[model samples]
Target: MRPGATRVGIIDYGMGNLYSVAKAVEHLGASAVVSDRAEVLAGTDRIIFPGVGAFGDCMAALEARELTDFVRVAAQTRPFLGICLGMQLLMESSEEHGAHAGLGLLPGRVLAFPPGAMRDRDGRPLKVPHMGWNELHQLVAHPLFAGIPQDAHFYFVHSFYVEPANPELLAAFADYGFPFCAAVAVDNLFALQCHPEKSGEAGLRLLGNFLAWDGGGGPACGI
Candidate 1:
């Protein structure tokens, strides 16, 4: 928990690519411990909630492990980060398969891309699952944006996106059919729809920023 010696706990509920995230954290000189033990996570300076797979399944895993409430409370105080499905799980609920409940830490819903991929102006498929790299337009100034170029491309792979009821939670966005909350930050919470671990330089810069962020530096809700 000490400055410049932060210990990060990558929550492993048996779904996420823990090694990749842990490697990314370790590469940045921060100690990374990938575990599911609540006591271990409580001792870390920050927590990275990363996941993949279905919304219901992820919530089930968290609940099964009894880590859901801990995560909700953690996001309210410490520097907590959620990635992809991890981010979507923060919403109140999702329509992935018959209105499944979520962590409800953030005010939003996870909705699937409309039908199939919408056609671009040039008549090409925009592609669902939003697979591959895309540009992110910075919506507001935040510590996460430090040294990151505006509109920097990041790797993404998902069929759904988050819609924060309070738009102020949006830190950056990208337009597939329309703009969606690509990243969100409020108080001590930071979540992103894209995979910073796969985003190359821009993503690494973001990870580095998150590692150094003091939680007080990010723009608060309602600014």
Candidate 2:
């Protein structure tokens, strides 16, 4: 690691797209230290909690690794970014497979896209998992959206979406059939339902903005 380099801890609870997230962080000129060890992660300047797979399984993995509490504390105290399933885990609970408690870092619940409620512009049914790229509408002027277009397309692949208890917590929204929470920003914490690593330039710009952010919910300092 170079001197003065920003060390970003990519929390590895064994259910995340660790390699992709690490590569994205390193591509932005930051040192990515992927670890589950609280001691090692605590030493980093920022945290990227990335995850894939079911909500319950991911939470169970965090618990199994004894990193649940560590994650809760780390997110509140630093520049934390949660991606996909990682974002869902920050909620109070989820109804993915069954009722399951979450990290409670944020007040919300992850709910599935109602099976027959979604319809396309043509009145055709939209599929679950909400796969493929979708346009993200910025609801709030957040630092994380720096340089990203107001309706930029980002890669999304999920069956459930977050519903924050406080409407003020919503940073962005996207439509599969109807508008859904795409991102949330509160203080030092920022999370996204879309995969930045797979979203190309706009995605990278978002990640870069995150790296330059000072956890103040203001404009990034510039990478």
Candidate 3:
């Protein structure tokens, strides 16, 4: 590894999109280390928490690995990025399988989209998962979307969405049946409901921006 190269720790509690997220970081010229050990992760410059499973299950895995508190602390000190279910875990609680508590890093609740409330452009009932590509409506100007265009299409596959207590945390929204939180940014923490690793160029750009971010709440530099 090059001297002083960004070391991104992709948190692996057996539920995240580990390899793909690591590869994405490596592709952006940063060192990617996917591990569950707090000591190993603590050595890195940034953290990427990516998940692809149920809220309760993922939280259990994190607890099993004794990483729940580790993550909560890490987010405060590093440039933290959470993706998909990883994003939901940062909230106060989730209603996925029942009332399950979250990391409470962000003040909010993860809620399931009401069934039969969403309709396609053609007026057909949309699926619950809300899969495939969708347009992101940028609600706030942040470094995470520095190069991405407004209303850019990104990949999404989720039934639950986060509702933050503080509206200022909202970075972007995407319409499924109605507008929903697609991304949130606060201080050093930035998270996304969409899989930027799977969203192609725009996603890659976003990841690159994250790799270069200094957690200063300003535009990413040295990209």
Compute each candidate's TM-score over C-alphas.
0.95, 0.96, 0.95
Q: Give me the displacement of residue 67 in model 1, in angstroms.
A: 0.3
Q: What is the Cα-based lDDT of residue 97 in candidate 3?
A: 93
Q: Write the per-residue lDDT of candidate 2 for residues 125-155, one digit (tens) a residue.
A: 8988799999999988888898999999999
The total number of steric clashes, by the backbone 3 Å criterion, in model 2 comes to: 0
Cand. 1 TM to true fold: 0.95
What are the lDDT scores of the predictions, listed in order?
A: 0.87, 0.90, 0.90
Worst 10 residues of 1 by lDDT: 115-124
Tens digit of lDDT per residue, candidate 3, span 1-223? 5667799999999988898898888888899999999999999999999999999999999999999988999888889999999999999999999999999988899999987678867888988898999999998778888899998889998889999887878889999988999998888889999999999999999999998888976433211
Summarize candidate 1's per-residue lDDT along 1-223 as a digit string, tens digits.
2356789989999999798899899888899988888888999899899999988988899999889878987888788899999999999989997799898888889998886556666767887778998899998888888999999999999998998999888899987877778999887788899999989999999999999988877768731
In model 2, state the lDDT of residue 121: 89
How does candidate 2 score on lDDT?
Answer: 0.90
Off by over 4 Å in 1: 1-4
